[model samples]
Target: MEKKKISIDKSACIGCGCCAGTYPEDIAIGADGLAESVTGVAEEDVASVCPVGAISVEE
Candidate 1:
């Protein structure tokens, strides 16, 4: 299976903590108050909790 890459559209991010809570190991709240990935973590749980749809998984 192809490795999925996670992407966050900062402009579309509403500063929600859902992604951060869901994927603490990879997702975090950046200084800009947006959801950011520490690395290219592919987590379906994080994407599912994103309300503004700022998270995307590329495979």
Candidate 2:
């Protein structure tokens, strides 16, 4: 199987919780009040849901 990489740019993240709400298994809010990649991989569409364009999925 192919591997996927999920990245969250803290500077761009607004901590909106949109990603977490959409994919709780793959994302979460960190202690710093920023979005974080929980599984190191997530649905590619996750990038599109971020209002701040903070998330990215790379294959």
Candidate 2 backbone collisions, by pair: none
In model 1, the clashing pairs are: none
C-alpha root-mean-square deviation, candidate 2: 2.2
Best by lDDT: 2
TM-score of structure candidate 1? 0.84
Q: What residue runs in model 1 are displaced by over 4 Å at the alpha carbon?
A: 1-3
For residues 1-59, could you state the per-residue lDDT of candidate 2 as single tens digits? 33368899999999999999998988999999888888999877788899988987786
Among these predictions, the greatest TM-score belongs to: 2
Roughly what TM-score does model 2 have, to 2 decimal places?
Answer: 0.87
- Give the lowest summed-lDDT range of ten residues in model 1: 39-48
* lDDT, candidate 1, 1-59, per-residue tens: 23367899999999978888877878899999998888787565557788888898875
lDDT of each: 0.81, 0.87
